[model samples]
Target: MATKRFAPTPTPSLLSSFTTRPCCLNTSLRALLPATRPFSSTPTPQNWLTPKRGESSKSRKGKPHVATGGSVRGTTLVWGDYGLRLRSHDRRISAHQLKVADETIRKRLRGTKYRLYHRVNANIGVYTSGNDQRMGKGKGSFDYWACRVPVSRILFELKGDVHEQVVRDAMRLAGNKLPGLYEFVRKGDPPVMGITKVGLVGNSEEFLRRPRVPVEAPSLPHTAQRIPGTTPV
Candidate 1:
């Protein structure tokens, strides 16, 4: 008997056999892929942190040399008695710059009770005779006389430009906020009292000045005279 044999046809290529569903991917997985569009590599604004170079520390110093409590870069309040000890550096600071520093401090320390004080001393120049120069001597000098206020009264020292705006906005939203709080207003031609101690010490001309007013004054009796007793019908 003779047997018939049949040859099998060759199979299609593996690539041809495989199927794809439009290259679909999950939403989260799509996020992992690189952005197709060009991106701007700009950094976002940062709050509660010191400004970068070429940015003003509001004219006091390029950087705040003295930060008391917590790490200067952290969000938590650095709790401690912060102070500024100005050394004579031929440069003098401008009035505007002092305003900047005051505002900066108020903004950074908002919601936290911290005291601030300012003091001025004679800068004994590197090789000069007396340490008699006050801070804020130069129009743009880095050296300046300033102090931190007490933690309790810190909120009252806010400046008009930035700090006042913030307070005004807050008040508009909440209405008559921070009641009983007092603000220190700068006065006079240069808008600063010459050097005076936290209580009164250094030269006045070159030092940062605070407003002075009698905190407690007695009220006098009404000067108007009373009418004689009269009966009404």
Candidate 2:
């Protein structure tokens, strides 16, 4: 019999040679695969990286943080802001009270020799008996209003018992006289002439009282006496 000459059986390593050449095998397999095969099993893109609570993307990055109680000159109050920028020393007054006081002063001093200077924080500074035209025109020479007023007077008239003593003490410490208008600000008395060197000629009591007037009744004689013997009943 002729000797059997079968092609030598390929070695196991030779039979699996494609495994060692992954690049070549992958290219060939990909070309043969379907184009629409699902590329990945992963889910669609998500917006999970969006901003979370208390994290603002547009936050101010450059401005310095201003702490409370910080004082900056020329800063003004922001209306309707809930008093966030209010100063501790600022005095508060009602709008009605201010209007009433202003009208009262202007009416009383009409054609008078004095002027009113309304200062900040609702305080009124009166130039007592000052020349009306020259009141605020020239430098200080005549009687001018000062911040110091007897705490007693302010409390009695403006603030009542609550602020009276406090104002008085403050005035005393400052060595300043109380506002001249305090004399007419008595609780029971009607408004009186305020402090004025020009009108200081008369005594205070006399000035306060109203001038008296005399009246005469009509003189009529009894008609019976004149009528001859008309019964004197």
What does the lDDT come to for candidate 2? 0.33
lDDT of 2 by residue, 57-149 (tens): 222212222322222221222221110111122223333344444455445334544323332222223233445656456433323222222
The regions of model 1 sitting more than 4 angstroms off are: 1-80, 120-233
Please state the error at residue 216 of candidate 2 in Å: 73
Q: What is the TM-score of each candidate against the true structure?
A: 0.19, 0.16
* Model 2 spans > 4 angstroms off: 1-92, 119-233
User: Model 1, residue 135: displacement in angstroms?
Assistant: 30
**Superposition error at 186 for model 2 (Å):** 15
Tell me the lDDT of model 1 at 110: 70
Q: CA lDDT of each candidate?
A: 0.34, 0.33
Q: What local lDDT does model 2 show for residue 37? A: 73
TM-score of 1: 0.19
